[model samples]
Target chain A: MKIAVCVKQVPDTWAQKRLDPDDKTLDRESVDGVINELDEYAIEEALQLGEATSGEVVVITMGPDKASETVRKALAMGADSAIHVCDAALHGSDALATSLVLAKVIGDRGFDLAIFGSESTDARMSVIPAMVAERLGQAQLTFAGKVDVEGSTVKIRRIAEHGYDEVTASLPAVISVVEKINEPRYPSFKGIMAAKKKPVERLTLAEVGVPADQVGLAAVASAVESFESAPPRAAGTVVTDEGDGGVKIAEYLSSQKFI
Target chain B: MAEILVLADHSGGEVKKVTLELLTLARSLGEPSAVVVGAGAGSTVDALAEYGARRVYVAEDAELDRHPVAPAAEVLVQLVGPHSPAAVLIASTADGKEIAARLAVRIDSGLITDAVQVDADLTATQSIFGGSVIVKSRVTRGTPVITVRPNSTAPEAAAGPCEREDLSISLSDGASRAVITNRVEEKHDARPELAEAAVVVSGGRGVGGADGFKVIEALADALGGAVGASRAATDAGWYPHQYQVGQTGKTVSPQLYVAAGISGAIQHRAGMQTSKNIVVINKDPEAPIFEVADFGVVGDLFSVVPQLTEEVVKRK
Candidate 1:
């Protein structure tokens, strides 16, 4: 069995991110980039599955040249090899185009299963996994909090409104796992050194057989017409407690008609 | 006039509040036509009509309820082929987004998720990057398929006599690939839901431990509000992660929000800054939470919270 894990590099969650004033796009240059926090869990799950089945795990990502760092991180975490689809024409692609490119790559690899985080930290669209599955005409199981893979069937505990539901799908399916699935392991020094020698395959839009006109900023189906920075919060009155602060708060609530 | 299709989200014959909110928003763009799936359309028709639904499409199929998402998307795609409505609106729940994505893929339409506002011209306002940036967008391709965030708009009734249309669709073989085998409903709690509550009180790492949530719960009960927690508190095991209010957790825009002992990191603020009024209580005088607070009290939350709850109870 062969496994594919899709990963993305996003701005660090702790960094102060900004948007470009002209195009309203994210100012990626201003912040430090790291592998999306949740993708680490996906990589770990794939590595564990690979070990259990005596198979191989392949990590794939689509981004600019700097994204190689993200692929290297996954390789260091125990993936057998890596694939990076780097092309200027892929910039500003919407979820549909992105899913198409990923599905093409996964189909070419002929994997038994594909894994992804429930959503990226930056986009947070939570729709790409389903879109990719639709493009491939395969089964999609998302928001999996617990996963178990038997001979040819995969069962998952899916999180829902109130509780959870048990969902099952066959092999050659796509699934997205949530953060609660498992704890990710840190890469050892030996693994890091080994990753330096592993194969890293690079592909472009044409190399992957994706038409240039079907992707990129010009091909996007949605356009941002306008944007504005969030307004700063104004300073309000602060009351120091002198054993009567509770009474003052009660008065304020009353004045605001909250009581 | 073009009709706007709304996917009604219902459970046990009762429609969710987000569905009504979507109907209200749909009416602003075009005539609202609700598409009810599964077996509960009869029970939801009156409520859908009350919210300005001019027509209701009832698609009662047991296969839809048994399978996950794909069957429902198939129904929508079949309807879209004939109706060609101006747009489709759905609540931005996990399941709803997946359905919308599949529908968009099948129909070759543009899909937008987590929209906070929609205009008469069909432009949408989205708060991206955890509400730090606001962008106005419009679909440039086929009919727009949008999933709106809950609590973004209030529901208003516009009573009308609704027309009903029964839709019949054939389920494709691929629709049954992923099947749900079992479901477990969580134990019910008496407190109001965090997203629907008008007033919310949240605690953070400053609360210290699991037992420390007692004061926060007492305050919420006294004020008839809901209780929430920062991710830091949930990650520390002080509360359940479901109750966490942050970028990664739930986004709540209530009428009144009270923060106790939270320092208001950007991630935490993203969930609650859209609230109408904010009140903060923290021992740290220079906490970031005070900057966004309408009222601030500098003191120990352990001491301040109990007294505030007592005052609220007394007033009531």
Candidate 2:
């Protein structure tokens, strides 16, 4: 019942993120980095599942050397170990390339299940889980609000358009969870001390069998052609309610043909 | 003319507004051809034709509906090899993006999601980091697979005779990896879908509790619009999470968005900033939502919302 959870290091949501002027890609260095908010939920879910089944949870992340800080945070939260896929040539890889490397790593590691956040706050593509599942030739159950495992069968309450649906798949599958699934736990001081000694394995692209020709900015399948800053919002008209505010709103709605 | 393939989204034998919006955007890129999957393609042809679909590829395979999204991606993969369209457009719904992702992998194409705009040259304008940054991107390797955000464009009616092409697709074992055991349709409400609604009334933490949503619902009903809630309210269990409007929630670009008792956080603003017109009502005058609002009213929502609903009802 070993599980692998994918985590990403992203610019903190509170900090203002900017795009690089030359390449139109995210300027990661300009802002402070933190683990993506949603991935915390995935880490927590994996830890809980591990405790429930007496299994091991391994945290995997792909980024520069600094991304190990993110993996340490997950280990402090109770994962068994960590895997860091760090390489200079992996920069600016598209979802396809990223999923390729992840699939290869997870496939080699031999996990009973793989977990991912529904999307990354940075890219917000929400595609990697499906792509990795397709590449690994495994079942994918994404956007799960609730997950349950029983006797090699995994069941999930999938978030659908209006409501939810019950979806089921076999073991050795991939799943991505939504934020509503569970509350993430904070790392205690004892956990933080213990995490420092936990095993962290670092791997390069070549170690993972990813060809040098398939990744990086030059080999990226997608390219940013251009960018434009969003237009500044105009000053809005504010009205203090002096008992006639409702009347003012009605007039405004009518002026806009809304009512 | 180069053809752009669009995956038509339909439910209950009717085409969704997002599909029409995709068709409208597709026409600007190239000649729009719709790939209709499931049992209702025949019934949806008229609407597709009205929205400028020159050709509709129909795959009436029952396995598509029985299984999850893999079968549809397989169908699209088969079509991509033969048609070699300039680009593929899909609605950026949960299921739609999944299909697009699988199709991109199967065909080894670059994929873009949540595109707010696509230029005639096929460059996609993406609003990322909770709408804090905008990047224009394009697929450099192969035919681009793009998922357009709902309500990004207004659907325009352009009459055309839609030619139908029947597609016979065989499902692979991978397509049946995940099976849907049961489905429960959401309760039908008269209000329009939040993503497609012209007007949306949303509440936030200032609403106090679940009971406070009554005033918001009344105002929404009076306006014949959809009801939305901020993540704060939804997380507090005041409303269903599905109705949440924020970075982690649904992105809505309605014509008019009313925020009552909402002290708009950046996450919430990211979902609704593209709205054509925004109105904010809050007790706090320093609310961030007022920054992007077209009009603002500083007052308590309980008093302001009920009076606004009454005024709106009286006007009609």
Candidate 3:
């Protein structure tokens, strides 16, 4: 099985991330960047499946220069090789453009399975994999808590609103896994050293067949008009437990007409 | 008036609250048409009509429900071909977002998900950075595709002549590739869904272990609300991941949120800071959850939860 996993470099989850005032894009330079926490699971899943089938696990990422760090991490985690799609014209690309570029890259590679984390943290839209699948004209089995691949068939226990549905799709499908799938392994010293020697192929829009005009904010469909900090919530009454704390809460609820 | 298509999410023939909320939001933009797709699509017209659906387009087909989201996206794409609606609105569930995503790609449109509000001009206001920063955005390309969060709009009743239209669609091989093998419905007895609940009671690390969640459940049950868990508690194996409320889990905007034993991390706050009223109870007085809480109680959840449950039950 030829497995491909898409990893994204996002600002540290713990960092106070902000949008650049000039472009309304993420302020990637101000904060430390790390592999999106969930994408680690995606790479891990691909690595495990790759090892099982004696296949190659190629990590795919599309971002700025700093995003290569994320690709290196995936490589360090035992991925065979990495592809970094980087270009200045890629800035401010919405989910559509980003997926368009990713689909083009994956289309050229011709992988049997393309995997992604369920959603990116900053955007949290959780729509890229579906968009990519739609663009690729393939089946999308996304939001999977568990994924199992057979010969020419893939099955997943997709997390849903009520419970989980066991979904099956043919090969050459798009699969996005949730965090519950598996615990990602940390890179070993040997693996980290080996990752430094692994091949990193860098590509641009021209190589992917997507035009510069079709991507980035200038050609995008959606635009963020303006933004501001939400007003701070006023501090409410704080009461120490005086043996009547529960009673006091009941009184407050009653006053608020909750009970 | 231009049509505004609203995908009515349903299960077992009953329409979900978020669809009504979407209908209400779509009315602000243009004529609201509710698209119900499934074998049981006809059963939800009354409820959709009650919430101001001018027309309910029912597409009855097993293939649409058998697949994940591709079939539904195809249905919407077919509907949009002739209607050319002003915009498309869907409930921002996991599947809903994916449907909107694929639809945006097929239609060459801009997509926005999890919007808290929508203006008349098709602009959407979203709570970002864990509900701390507010951003206003709009679609600039082709047709705008947007998803609305549950409870974001107060559903108002506007009795409409709910005209029924049957849509015939032949699924392409692209939309029919994925097949659902099995479905295991969630087993929560009589408890409301966490996202749709008006009141939510959540537990955190202070709940101790899996058994400690019983107290949390009791409180939620007493108040006739849903049970939620902080990421710490869920990660610690006290609860399931689906019940986890945080940036990585389900985002809930409820009328009232009672958080017990949680130390409000930015992640947890991001999922629920938009809640109208918050009450936090913790042994630690300095837990960050108190910063945004409407009421804070400095006490152990073990004691406070039971007592609160009893008080609520007695009041009822």
Best by TM-score: 3
Candidate 1, residues A1-259: lDDT per residue as tens digits? 7999999999998887776777656767788889988899899989988999998999999998888989989999999999899999988888989998999999888988899998888888889899988888878888888888899998888887566889998988888888757889998999999999999999999999999998888888888898877676677889998887767777888899988
Show model 2 residue runs off by greater than 4 Å.
none
lDDT of 1 by residue, B148-237 (tens): 987778899999989988887787867778889998877236676676677899999899999999999999998988899998998888
lDDT of each: 0.87, 0.89, 0.90
TM-score of 2: 0.97
User: B1-316 in candidate 3: lDDT tens per residue?
Assistant: 8899999998868888788889888888899999999889989999999998999999988878889898889999999888899999998888899999989998999999999999999889999988878999999888899998888988887887889999888988878888998989984958877887888999999889999999999888888889999999988888988898997888999888999999999889989999988999999999999999898899988877788888998998
Quote model 2's iRMS: 1.6
Best by lDDT: 3
Clashing pairs for predicted structure model 3, backbone only = A221-B140, A221-B141
Worst 10 residues of 2 chain B by lDDT: B187-196
Superposed by TM-score, candidate 2 places the C-alpha of residue A246 at a distance from the truth, in angstroms, of: 2.5
Order the candidate numbers by DockQ, best to worst. Answer: 3, 2, 1
lDDT tens digits, residue span A14-93, model 2: 88888787766677777888998889989998998888899999999999888888999999999999999999998878
Whose DockQ is greatest here? Answer: 3
Interface RMSD after interface superposition, model 1:
2.2
